[model samples]
Structure formats: C-alpha cells, structure tokens
Target: MGLRVSKGQSIAVRAFLSVLCLGVACFGAGCDGNDQSSEYIPENGAKIGASVADVMKDWLEDPDVPAAQRAVLERVAATGDMESLDYEQSWAQYRQCMTDLGYREIKLQKYPSGLYIEALHLAGTARQESKYEEDRAQCTAEHVEYVQAAYAMLAGNPNLYEDADEAVVDCLHRENLVAADYTASSFAEESARGEEDDYSFDIRDMKARSCLASNGHLTAFIGDDVEERLW
Candidate 1:
C-alpha cells in the first residue's frame, strides 16, 4: 500500500512516496532512502481507534471538498474499516489508470506481503517533471491515496497505539535498546529536541532508527537493494 500523508490531518500519517517512489515495501522492507516524499507509507495508532467518519472529517466536511476525495470518503464509509483495501483490485484499477494516462510500460512483482512495482521508471519520460507529477498525483488521488494511507498507518503500527510517541519509547525499552527505567516523559522531551534527546537509545542508531520509523517517530531510508511488489 502506497499511502501519502496529507498535512491537513494532524494524524501521524507520513508521506507514501517514501515507499512508493523508491520502490520499497510498505512494511517488510523499509523505504529508508526516500525523498521523504509527502506521500506513501503507513500511518497508525494511539490507542484511540479512529472510525471511518473520524478520518473522513479531515476533508469530507469541507464545503469545497474535491469530487475525487469525496469519492474516497464514500468508498471508505462503505467498507467500515481502513485496512479493508482490495490490494489486487486497487492495483489493477491504478495500473489501468496510469496506462490510460500514457504510463504504459508499467510492470509489477509479487512479494510475500503484497504486489509492488519493480520498475516504474517514471523518470523514463522526457516530459516536464512538473507535468508528470501532476498526472501521477491525479491518478493516485483517484485510486489509491486514502485507502493506502489508512493501510500504511495500520500496517506500521498494527497495535494502533493512540499515543505513538509513547509506543516508540516502549518499543525501545522492550528491545533492550534503552535503560529499563526510561520513561515516556523522557521520550517526549528527547524527541522534541531532535536526535540529541535520548530516552535511552541513540535515535540515529540503526536499531533505534528502525524502532522510531516502525513506531512512526522517525523516517529511515532503507537501502535500494530490497525486493518489492507494488499494489
């Protein structure tokens, strides 16, 4: 699932391009090398579960909500669960949409988790980069945007800890990456100060980085070498 974060929501939804554009697996293989693209990747929990209506309120209630986003809201409303995306089906729809828009050489690979794009040389075109971006954005918005966002959030933090910051600290301590006595207060203070603040572990350490990214506290760009399938 390639979910891009929208700044409109205060939710910790990170950009999906971190996963999609770099050809990384949404969960299994981290997109540790992304452009930190404003979209693609998972979003998640804080213990306070989000209902379809709750998330929809981010855009649906707007008097000027775009027809496309409104459509996504309706689709999610029908499913009643964000994790309910039909990966194969949405990928098919998205593939055809991209092809129709002239990105015909598309190809996909299957991974243990889901389908992914092995080579979407979006850079293959000589067209203006801006134009390509516009088209790509349109296609994503219509088909995969919101569903993928919800999927990423749930996938990365399956427990859906409503307080993700606390969760990250917990994971660090659980993994023995930090002193057992480290507290959430320490985690918050440190996270607020960038990498210097340590609830017990160095945020930049490989294992620590993984814990932060996995818990939605930081972004880690993985090596481009990992295998993937795009759906």
Candidate 2:
C-alpha cells in the first residue's frame, strides 16, 4: 500500500516520486541550497481516496483470496461513502491475516493515497521471504498488474515532456536543480527495481516534481490527455 498522489482524474504516480525526492533532498541544502521544510509533505486528498477505491475493487475481485474475506472487504469498501474510509482498520485485517500466516516484521506505512506493507523479514524457514512474496503476489495480482501496466505505459512514452514550455527547462537550470531525463521506459525499470528491492519511497522524491513545476512541466506531465491515458 504505497501512497500515491494525483491531481484531478490522474494518479500522479511519477509526480509523487518526483516531489518525494525533492522533499527529501532539496530541503537539506544538498541540491537546491535551501533548507528542507518538514511541513512540505505532498498532499492530494482526492487522489488518495480514488486510489484506495481502485485498490479495493481489485481486492474484492481477487480470485486467490477467500470468499469470506472478500465479503468482509466489500463491507469495508462501502464504508468509505465516497468521502473518507477507515484505512487503518481495513489494512489491519490484511496485516493480521498475513501475520497469522507467519509473516514477521510486517510494517504498514501511510502514504497520501494508501498504505504500503513492508513484510521485511519473515519467520520460519530460510525461504521465508520468497514464500511471503509468493503469497503476496497471489493475493494482489490484479492490483499489481494494473499498476505495472500504468507505469509501463508511462515509461514507454519518451516524449511526454516534449510539449513542455522551454521556460520550464530554463527555470530548472536557473534554480540549479538536478533534473533526471525521465521516460516511460526508465520509470518502468526504476519502479520494478523499487518493488523487487523493497526500496522505500518508491524510488522517487519531491525534487523532481518541484523542478518540473518550477519549470512549468506539470502541464505536460499531468495534462488532461495524459491523465485519461494513465488512469
């Protein structure tokens, strides 16, 4: 349950990473020569709610899951009422189920969109991590597939920023910011590695988003057309 953000109909998965990287590094005088503000955690309440609904849909239909549990999840899903939902309790049940199955070190972290489950080290045999991974894949295959497809589409398109205004790039340079040449392919690879290695923060930060916005890249990065395609 990694937290993701978006503006309007688009889930700014990459945007979330971009901003997160900035928030972590730029605030420390390491990149932007400015002190990082602890208060600047990116927020997109609308996106968070939408993302949870998306995940819940898959959870309810996950064939690998038990019917009883899915029924319980359906009730939980309805509790959102399109405004707010008890994410803590909803995720707690999942965590407890995993724990009952012998997965240790289960850590649940809150993100703007949803929760991220970190089953760091499992108990039992030497192949504990492998076993846990198998179970997780089986449980959340549909949700995982949807996310992978979205990221893959984003990664494949290299010219996503071509339409961005030149002023955006100029502003980034003027600010002395470090901007990565982001592409759909590069993002896909990075995203895959982040999951495989269990890298926290989803392999992105706030700097990227801040730099892009300062340079006027948001229009290109999060245009309505792009949102429709990604969502």
Candidate 3:
C-alpha cells in the first residue's frame, strides 16, 4: 500500500471514496518452495495473467530487487493472486512502526489499490519534524514500499497497462459507459477540459463511476462501495 501524510484528509483516499470500485479477490493462495538464493528464477507460470510470469522472469535478473520483493513475486507467481504478496500485513507492520515512533492517530483508508493514509497528526519542532521525516522514510521503506509495488502489479489495471489513463479509457469503452461513437481522442479532449474545469462525466452516474474506479481513475467525485479503516 502507498501512503501520503496529511493533516486534515488524504488526497488519494478522497479521490478513492468518490467512485464505485470493483475488484475480484481470489480465495485460495500459496507459494511454491522455490530456492530463493542467487540461483533463483521464476519457473512457475503465470496464475493471475499471461504477463505475470514474464514480469517475474525479468525482475529476477534485476539486482536492485530486494529479497523480500523477490519472495513476494514468487508467491504471486505460485498463487496467481496479488494477495499472496501480503501487502496488508506489511502495511500493518508499517503502521505499527509509525505508531511506535510516537505518531498518534494514524488514520488509514482502504482503496482497491490497497491501504492509504487518510490522515496523520505530526507535531514537533522543525528539527523533530525533520527527524520524523527520516524515520518515516526508513519505516516505509522497510515495511511497505516494494511489497506494495508487487501487489500493485496485479491489483492495478488487471490488464497491466502502462498508461493508467489509457486503461481507464479502454475500461470505460469496454463497460459501455460511453456512447458507441465515443473515441479515445474525444476522451482525451474531455480529459483536458475535465482537469481544467472538473467537467468530466457526472461521477454520480453509477456505471461511469464503477468503470472509472476499476480502470484506475474517476474515484474522486462520488462515494459508494468502499471501506474506511482507522489504523
């Protein structure tokens, strides 16, 4: 899960609550007993999507990937599910780490992507705040960052799209939320106007909202079908 620190509310959480989101969660999950040393490689095939095996194959060769991340990848490969990455557990670890650091009332919000920071109450002198930043960085890095990325690889845009906008546009079209004559070009134009004036499709429209939420956009204007957790 990714998090943003804020005093009043979280931008990501607010955006998430505004749209109806949809997701499929697999019930069964497990990982193969793969030797996770320098000799490790992803022999397990893709369980979630066709591309996951390929992604795991590439990441195995990248030296920057930490053992924790690689282990999560192996689990994802074995189970064909993002939950195998165990990001929620890691987020809990992160939350506990922050709480132990003296941060009180660390509110969290749930999103289709995962847990997000709804609010954080940070108070101290400038020097202490600076030290807090350093600690937050350390805690987040050790607990959430890479595991969250691995989970996102599956949870975000089931199509594994490189462009979030394009994925959302395609999803809108696939769900028949837009007119048959609507083109990506038209959507692009609307997006420009939408940003400048917030003139996008009415977020209150249920189909449109769900399409936007699932395809990875348009979850910032309405509220339904979500969970808010205080962490």
Q: Write the per-residue lDDT of candidate 2 for residues 1-231, one digit (tens) a residue.
A: 222222322333343233211121111111223222222111111222244445446545647645544544455456532222333443455556556665543453222223222322223454754676566554333233223222211222111232222222322333333233422233334334433233212122334333333221221211112111100
Model 1 residue 220 distance off true place after TM-score fit, in angstroms: 8.4
TM agreement with the true structure for every prediction:
0.47, 0.33, 0.54
Point out the higher-scoring one by TM-score: 1 or 3.
Answer: 3
lDDT for every model?
0.47, 0.32, 0.46
Provide the global lDDT of candidate 3 against the true structure.
0.46
Error of 2 at 138 (Å): 4.5
Candidate 3 is scored at a TM of 0.54
Please give, for residues 1-231, the per-residue lDDT of candidate 1 as tens digits.
232222224444334233344322222221222111112122333353465456555535655544654565566556654433464455667678777876544465332224243243434344544555677667665665554555444334344455555555555554456654455566667555543432345544455544454443323233434332222
**Candidate 1: worst-modelled 10 consecutive residues by lDDT:** 33-42
1-231 per-residue lDDT for model 3 (tens digits): 211111111122222322212221111222122111222112221222347655555555656555666677677667657673376677788779877987653555355345343232334677866776677667766675555544544554345444434444455555445544444455557554544234234444444444444433433432233333222
Report residue 118 deviation for candidate 1 (angstroms). Answer: 8.3
Q: Which predicted model would earn the best TM-score?
A: 3
**Candidate 2 segments exceeding 4 Å error:** 1-84, 112-114, 117-126, 138-231
Model 3, stretches more than 4 Å misplaced? 1-50, 112-133, 171-199, 202-231
